[model samples]
Structure formats: C-alpha cells, structure tokens
Target: MDLELRHMRYVLVLAEELHFTRAAARLGLAQSALSAQLGRLERHLEVQLFERSPRSVTLTPAGEELVARAGRLLADADDIERQLRTLSRQPTAPRGLRIVAETIHPEVVNALAQRHPGMAVTLRHDTAEDGMAALAANTADVCHGWDLPSVPLRMRSGIAQATLVDEPMWAVLPEDHPLAGEEQISLAQLRTAAWVSPGPGTRRARHLLSVCQAAGFTPDIRYVVDDQEMVRTLLANGCCVDLAPPRHLPEQGCRAVRLVEDVRARLFYAWRRDSVPGWLAREILEESRDAFVAGLVRRGPLYARLVEQEPARFGPLLDIDPAGWPAARIPVPALVSTA
Candidate 1:
C-alpha cells in the first residue's frame, strides 16, 4: 500500500486541529469523508496515530513523530516548488537563502534585503528544534538557535556551525522575595520556591532541570509557559520565580539577579556543511552580528548598564560596542562548498 502526500497533509492538519469537525471544516470536507480518509491512511501505515475518545483526540507517540517528519517534508516540497517557479521565470535568478530561527530580528532581514538586492531571502520563526530539523531536511539554508554548552545540541551530520552569542542566564524574582536582594543567588537557594518553567521536553526546561539537579535538587516548577513576557509578569506579581538572560530588566516589582552557577547560554548560526556557498555564510554572519548588536542597543539604558557592569558576562557584545559602532570587521570562517 502506498500513501500519497495528501494523506500525510491530512494527518498533519488533523493532528493540529485534534477535532474531526474542526479539521474537516478547515479542509472543506464533510466530517464523515475526513474520518474515512484518516481510516484509509492509518490502514496504509498500519499504525494507530491518534487516540480517540468521546471528549478529545490526541496524537500517540507515533503520531507525534510522524507530524514532525511530515512538517519537514512539506517545507522541503514548498522550497522545491518555489525554486522551480523562480527558475522557470528567470533562468539565472539570484541564488536563494532560507533561514529558520527561533526569533528572526527584523533588522537582520532588512539589512540583508538592502545589501543583497538581487538575492532571494526568506526568514521563518520556528522553534530551535524545528529550525535545526529544517536545515537537516534541506528546507532551510541556515538556522539560528540557543542552548547551554553542557546540554550540547544533537546536530545532524554534515552541519557546520559558528557561535554568535555566549551570555549568562539571570534569575528573575519579585523584589520582595528573600533572595532577590542578593547580588547573586545560587540555584540551591531557590529549590523550595515554585518556579516558572518552559514545560517538559523543551530545551529550556531540560536545561533548567539539569542546572537544578547540579545544585542538588529538582526545581519545583508550578507553571509551564512559553512566553517571556508572561514569565516576567509572573515574577513581578509574586506568583513564581524564573530565569532569563541578562538582557531582561527587573521592572518596578521584580529584580533580575545574577545566577552564581557557571552555566553559559550560547547562540549558534548553522548551515548544511555540504550545500551552503562561502559568500552566503560570510554575509549571514555579518548581518547576524549587526542584528544582535542592534537588538541589544534597542533595549535601552538598562541593557547598556548591564553590559557595562558585566562586560565579560556579555561575551561577544563587548566587541560589538553598539554605541561606538566599531569599525573592525569580525571574521567568520569561509565555507568550503562541497556541492
């Protein structure tokens, strides 16, 4: 039995919507027809992808794995179609670069747009995990991600990477919290407090767990949220304690303290070692540096003060000198294209 691309797409949409009626409505098909299609796809794969109950539908482990792979496949198909269309219109269309980053700074995209008027550039905001997957799947030409060095990223083979930012994580707490008055609070000190977490299985959550474990106790994570602003709000309202990079400022009700532990957060720029052209890699690195620096500058006086107070903690930004706008060019390795 063979499964068509439409079958995979159907599974993806169903997995997203989780409700037969909603998925069917989105697909413009009757619920019964959608159910029949799902049944056919499952039979073809010989695996039950979802758990169905009167109240809800949820993906099984197999379904979760398939959804991830299917997303990459669909992105790759779209990229190929776009390239073919571009070539059909203009045989010598300028080469394209697709970047997948957790948060692509608009300044970076705009800078690239200005510098390389003829080249095609696309930036996608996806999770770090998805961004790396897209690079491995050839759907993205570059990926930007962050992780603790101790929790080393599990990179796919043939990927080349360069470190863009190396900075420290700061503790966020209500101004009146006992440890908030301290200049540097150790992880062990916060063990008893309810914490804001990024949720289980995510890199941020796993890193927090590892750090806490190293400090001799697992964190008491009371809330799981993905929004940084929500985390700030929680800490400010005396709801929970959390962590963020130094770039975060303590607002009126909360304080951003230094973590005594030596854990460092690193940001990386990566691309497929075999396929990326040298010129493209260099250009991307330069633009990324500009964007990173510009973002810090935009953070205003508090950020600049933090950087000044702890230049070593800020790493590469010391070289950035956003105010002075340093003239020296920081060199990145030229890619050796194997394609």
Candidate 2:
C-alpha cells in the first residue's frame, strides 16, 4: 500500500470536511478534480473510503483508519517541504517568527519592525505559561518577559531560554489612593488595602502571596484581571492596588513603586533552541530586544516625570535624582488630596 503525500492530504481533508466539494474549495482544487483524485486513491488502495448518502458522507471503517494514517504521513511531508523551503533561499519569502510577549512593548515592536521587514512575526499576548505552551507546540520561535534569574521555567517539554535583564516589579496604586502619599508602601503593610491581582496560581499573584505571607498576612484582594490597562484604571481610581513591572506602567495616570526589597517578580524568554534560526533575522530580533531594554533603563527620568505630574498617581514631581536611577527612583512625595 504505497500512498503519495497528495493522496494522504486528500484523505485527511476529505475526512475532516466530510464533503467533497467543501474540502476541495479549502484545498484550492476544482471539485471534479478532487473527486477524481479520491476515486483514484480508493481504487489504488482497494478500499471504499466513504459511505456516501444524499445529505452526508460518512467514513467507512477502512476510510477512518486510512484517514488517520494519512494524517501523519501528510504532516511529515508538509514538515519536510517547509524545512526545505526555509533552508533554501526562496526569493522574497519571509522566514516566520512567532514571538509571544507577556504584553506588547512598543520599543521592542518598533525596533524589530525596522530590521526585519521581510520576516513574519505572529504576536500573542500571553502569560509565561502561555509562552511555554506555545514553545511546546513548536508554534512560537521566541518569548520575552522580565529576565528573572532564580525562577526556572522548567517545562517537561522541548523549551529552553535565557535571562535578558534583572529589573524590579512595581506596585501600582491609584493617584488618589490614600497610600499614594508615601514614597513607597511595603507589600506587607498594604494588607488592609483592596488588591487587584491575578488568580493565586499566577506568578504575579504567587509573588504577592509569598510576600504577604512572609510579611505575616494574606493580601486583601478586590479584583483579579489579566489586562494591564484595566489594572491601571482600577488602581488609578484610588479604589485598589496591583503589581506589575514598573516599566510597563503608563507614562502618566498611574503610580508605580518598586516592591519594597522583599517582594519582587522577574520575567524571561523561552524558545525551542532548535527552532530558532542561525540567520540575520534572528540576530536582529535579539539585538532589538536588547536595545529596547536599554532604552527602558535610560528613560527612567521620563518615568519620573510621569510620577511628578500628580494630576493623579505620584503627585507633585520631585527633582530628577538619577542617583541610583533606573535601578531605583526616589518616590515622588505623594500629592496631598485637597478634598
């Protein structure tokens, strides 16, 4: 029983659609040609592949088995074709790069867009776990997040990664919140405040749990949302507090404080080492991630300016103290609530 990739593909697509005409449309083949191909395949294999009735087509036992077997063969053939095409210099064809980022970073976006004009990048807003999932499925080429050193993302699959930077996670509070007056509040000290955080299983939520538990209390939670903008607005209303990478905060409208020495979170990028290319596109992407991180570091003063505006968040800007800057910014003295 010798079957070609085209035959196998026809079987799989036919089985999936259970309709000769629709499957042909999906495969970009004429309906009559598709039917002829199926007839040839069935005759060659000496198997009646489908039980055709007026309204529906059902797979015969033999048809089901052949379709299943054909799926694997078709997949292998497709893989071989993709590998060959990419390995060869196909004119004007873009090498695909699937990158999963925790959230989008504008600098990284801009930097990469300029260098990799021909590269195809599929972006997914994913958690670190989502990134690991993408890596395991061989869907994504690279994943980026804060470069946490100690947190080993050991998935029981074919994923490996490295740290790009060590930075602090910030406690985001509403501009009008009572605690925003102080330069910073300890994670433990914020126990009575209503919190907006991820579910307990998440890394951010887990860090908050560990920190509060360490500080001798469980945190008071008000909301658990995944969206960053939602996190900012909820905190900005002075109703609840949350945590995130300080650098990820809006340049205005939110107050971000470094987790008081004890509570912190880090991020990293994971990829299947073998899937990444040893080509110019990969190198350029790596460089872009590096430059974006550097630019974030250098732009601490701009962040401070946001803090000082006190239109909300960190009120009444303090003078620029680049002392330990980027590493640490002096808390702008909280704006006094005139009300």
Please give, for residues 272-311, the per-residue lDDT of candidate 1 as tens digits: 7656665567777887777666656655444566666767
Candidate 2 clashes: the total is: 4
Determine the C-alpha RMSD for candidate 1 after optimal superposition of all C-alphas.
25.3
Error of 2 at 61 (Å): 94
Separate clash counts for every candidate = 0, 4
Per-prediction TM-score to the true structure, in the order listed: 0.64, 0.55
For lDDT, the strongest prediction is 1
Cα error, candidate 1, residue 61 (Å): 92
Off by over 4 Å in 2: 1-94, 106-114, 146-152, 155-158, 251-253, 278-286, 289-299, 302-339
**What tens-digit string does per-residue lDDT give for candidate 2 at 15-47?**
899998899998999989998988888888788
Q: Provide the lowest-lDDT 10-residue window in model 1.
A: 330-339
Q: Output the lDDT of residue 41, model 1.
A: 77
